[model samples]
Target: MPKIIEYPKGNFKNSLDLAEAVSSLGGSCDRESCAHKMGLKMSGAFGTKIGTTAKYELITTEKGKLQITELYKLIKNAYNDVERKKFETEAFLKPEVFNKLYDRFKGSELPVGMLSKLLIREYDVEEKQAVPVSKYFIDGLQYLNLLDGNNNLLDYNKSLEVEDDYAEIEDENDLPIKSNYSSPYLPEKPTAQILHIENKNNTTNRVEAETTDFIVHIMGPGIDSQIVIKEEEDLLIVDAMLKKVKKKLQ
Candidate 1:
């Protein structure tokens, strides 16, 4: 049981970036040369990305060389598109962040904004950074078909059943993290009618005006209520508070 790793941020921008970097070579390669070939500066940021790769069991260091693990080699040399997807799908689940998130909230749904704030609390991530992390997982997971159209992790009984090969994805932190060390989740920026919907009614999102009517759902610890949002002046008040929150973050 490999441990969960903090989501990595650096040279590899996204999943595709990571896959591309990993696919560029075979056998063992010198870390310095590999980093140089990747057009990334030899810095902690680059190391962070490599560390993340190792954490996901994609690459392992032998003596002074970075060697692709058998599992990763399998993913890269997948016989066909379907095999590639199967391996790639299993690869994402190896991260602690994804597993914990799926384990924590497999069925509930909420707004992207709220999820970003939750990441702030759970992982000590800054408000601004959490937004992108949320967005990455939000879009990436769905793109990988792990999450459905509604952006929720599909269940074990769903399309993706846990494969036995999943056990091979291992690294340090080989244990589930404490529950208290977590926060809620959602993406920060959703441009087009953005809403972090999970298909469950546990939490509802809203952002629309009906000529002169709107529905407002308020959620808090042990307190939940729905209010109608209609007055333009009321929208102003909400807008002002939003700025205040942003100001506080600044």
Candidate 2:
């Protein structure tokens, strides 16, 4: 028998409610306490709320306790609407299935009429759950303004760019990175100490930066590539490329 993929049984708003409840109890509480805070009884229905909040990556169950995640705290304590919405978008897209949908239909009109069929056919959504899952996904997009009035999905990062002069950034190390552009394979922050050794033959001096938050776009005749390094592990790709170049030169 084919494996049944897991999805949030409740909608996005319901999950948010569960998150709020978890927050009310000092960000972590026992299952019964959390359910009571949400005015929900200790039952399977309440379990679904917990499960759905977890699906959005807002809360985690640790040692029989439901705890709101740091993402949730960031959203709850966001200083401005833009910051809040950015974190909300992150929460909404946390699920693997939801991320898959966003990637497939980003900057394109959602197939509203055929979404259910598409979900089941392409995304492994169960036959019985295709409709509701599609509905919830669309609802989340609408709530987060990810879906525009004409049904075309907005560019996730472009829509959330923080407009500012940024002329005098307080910390030189804190690069202003667009949240959506972050890679899942990388650590959010990487720390490494660099040792510089002077060589008589080399005149180049290297300046080390704390993080890699820029995109490397290479375009030439019949060649187009975009390289994004969000963590130290990603440097292996660059190292391999340099090795190839050195071999060719040798």
lDDT tens digits by residue: candidate 2, 33-119: 987777778998788778888989899987898999999999999975567878998999888788877988897898888999987
Note the residue pairs that clash in candidate 2. Answer: none
Query: What does candidate 1's lDDT look like per residue over 175-250, in tens digits?
Result: 1111111112222221112123233365544444442455544343322333344432233223322333343455
Note the residue pairs that clash in candidate 1: 3-173, 3-174, 115-185, 115-186
Candidate 2's TM-score reads 0.62
Global lDDT of each model? 0.51, 0.68
Which stretches of candidate 1 lie above 4 Å from their native place? 1-5, 10-24, 62-64, 107-111, 123-129, 160-250
Best lDDT among the predictions, by candidate number? 2
Clashes of each: 4, 0
Which candidate's TM-score is highest? 2
